[model samples]
Target: MKQALQLLVLIFSLTVFGQNGNTDTAQVVIPGRYNSVEAQAKPYVIMISADGFRYDYAKKYHAENLLKYSNEGTQAKAMLPSYPSITFPNHWSLITGLYPAHHGLIDNYFYDYKRKEPYAKSNKKNAEDGTWYGGLPLWGLAEKQGMLSASVMWVGSASDAGGARPTYYYPYHEKFSPEEKVNKVIDWLRLPMDRRPHFISLYFPEADANGHHFGPDSKETEEAVHKIDQAVGQLVQKVKELGLKNVNFVFVSDHGMIKADNENPLEIPQLLLDKNRFDIYNSQTLLRVYVKNPDEVKKVYKELKANKTGGYKIYLDKKFPGSLHFSTKDDRYSRIGQILLFPEAPRIFLEKGEKSTAGKHGYSPKTVPEMKATFYAWGSAFKRNITINEFENVNVYPLVAHILGLKINGPVDGKLKVLKETLK
Candidate 1:
């Protein structure tokens, strides 16, 4: 009877596993690239993203601790965010180290042609769906490599990427205060040594929302900035108090915020009549027009080009500027709009009447300083008192992988050499 019960348990587990409709059905094998290595004496990594924190925020608000952090560890003056430098795309880029295009998340709100479902932050079902998300997320990567990770309100952390999530992750929530977030991270760290996660991700978004409402340069924005800085300070103090060594902490942001040019805004819906003409997920800073009907691609292209009244430029999918790297080269992942409409920087588009918000991102990183992000890492793994110049955000993936000694089965857009200077 005991043997029969054990056999039944095994069968139950198998049945449950088989019922999970993971996008990648194959059993994951840790690839050769991520070879097993001598585990470090102390291996703890923390990644905190202050949503909408610009590279210059440290300077603008005189965030003393953050500035001192820059001085004490490796600091990148500005981390260039991926094109369409907005919230979700840039946040995912930091972890996966793949551009939004490569990751199959072209924009914050896009329609999944395959699933016939909409991908939006508010849609819990879509947010948790693995079919809409592609590539290996860092949390899932840690799970595969026998390490543990935790995320507190980080984008994509809640999602079922390839049917895997962090060992511990809470779905995105706005009610959690900055202090609560810091305390929760400490709680995770204080777990029994054997159970503690080796990696943790935390996110604070008050700054982003504040910036959107009051503009990046507003005094209201400063309040959010001050609050986030205080939270950072509190986080460091808690770690020091805990006396945990061999820990690495990385401070980053998805993208910066800029004042919107609401004075002379171009209304997209007014400019084009066909609202349902292709699932055009339009935003203030950018527009991603994914065609519902393949035949309409040509018609849409002609309509966009003739709209000389607008301040945006339209490009064929293949003709977008190479520097932006906003489209995928691989045929397997090529699902971006056949007709790309790129609005010039600072100036923005509106679905209806003028200014969408006081400020925004999702503009060309090249032209807008606000679109640039920040990267400052200080810990056991990073060398002290180093200041590096600007670099693209995609390289961050290899940096995290190198610190953890993780390997991937396939090529990642981020190269390890670019981040070699950052290691101790």
Candidate 2:
């Protein structure tokens, strides 16, 4: 058992290290950009996302620095993730103030019937393409309003979403050390007033990676949480040394983690696997079926619905639960599949012979407590020692916008009023 655990750790190390080989770590600076006079006067915000960090992780894992900092300012009981609580969707939701359906990234991997193309997070070309994303992300909003922004590695930051990427950004890569990332933020903060980024985003992948490989309750995950806690402490210390005023930090996670029923995984229904009948996009937690022949939709739905066993729920796209905001009415881009399958907590769909990860997420937070993410804010902008009830992740965009004094260009699902009370 000890040898097996060591092998898993070594594999995880190699997976992360392998991505760094020959990968460019230079900061990409878009020339000819400067903060407008109004933007220059605004306060600074550093939004940090520790992917897969659960709501209770700080307390549960004894993340001392995070608990300390949050206790000093504001900490929410929990932060609810958007429907289909996965990495790409929720990150975009947090940044754009829109639900996944509204933002056009309904899932980490999904087929767009209109575009006749697939948007997979692992596909570098499409992931970097700005056109695939919708809703003006916070970085784009800042840039549009003449505030320079920087991103160490935030989803959609590397793309030209809303016709502008962050003025300073590094395309997503796993090679850079955590210390290097912190120093880069310090460098950006140290730039000349006009050139410095007022809005900066930093991302950490350790918790999520370890959680998936070793399960949320494992010692590996606890250690990963501690690493994040230390990194946060280091960042706060370094930033304080700079004596930057009105600089606030908002920490969040895209979604939480839960152990999966890996030993008894559900296999896809045989009827749905026929190539001529359906195009299936499976994410373990959610299975989307796009029927080829429109007429066959009812027949297939009936067969699958009647034959479906335990551990999952099936819904036709039009009849999907309205609360999830993933029903047909909310699909702005018509990207959602015709039929949807959502597995209950700890249950996931896996084909025969395919291995399941020890940990999994993407369940609806409303139904599964394990899907709830994290949110904590501290620094000059937030009220001290306050705790608020759980709120939707979309509200984060408006709160950040409010901090930076950026104007909301259009209607967004997030409302500043929801989080306005947390401010000093």
TM values, all candidates: 0.86, 0.95
**Tens-place lDDT digits, model 2, residues 143-246:** 99999999988988889988999999998887777778898999999989899899999999989898998999999999989998998999999999998899
The lDDT leader among the candidates is: 2
Mind giving the per-residue lDDT tens digits that candidate 1 earns over 1-424?
A: 2222112211201011112233332212222222123432437889999888999998899988888887898999899998778777788878888888878776666655565555655555666676777778777777677676788877777677855677677666554689988988898788766556777899988778888888999998898889998999999999989998888889999899888787887666443445455555565566656666778777767776776566887777767777888754632355566766677777876644323678778887888887898899998999899988888888988888778767766567788889789888
The C-alpha stretches of model 2 lying farther than 4 A from their native spots are 1-21
Name every residue pair that clashes in candidate 1. 34-407
Q: CA lDDT, every prediction?
A: 0.73, 0.88
lDDT of 2: 0.88
Candidate 1 backbone clash number = 1
Number of colliding residue pairs in model 2: 0
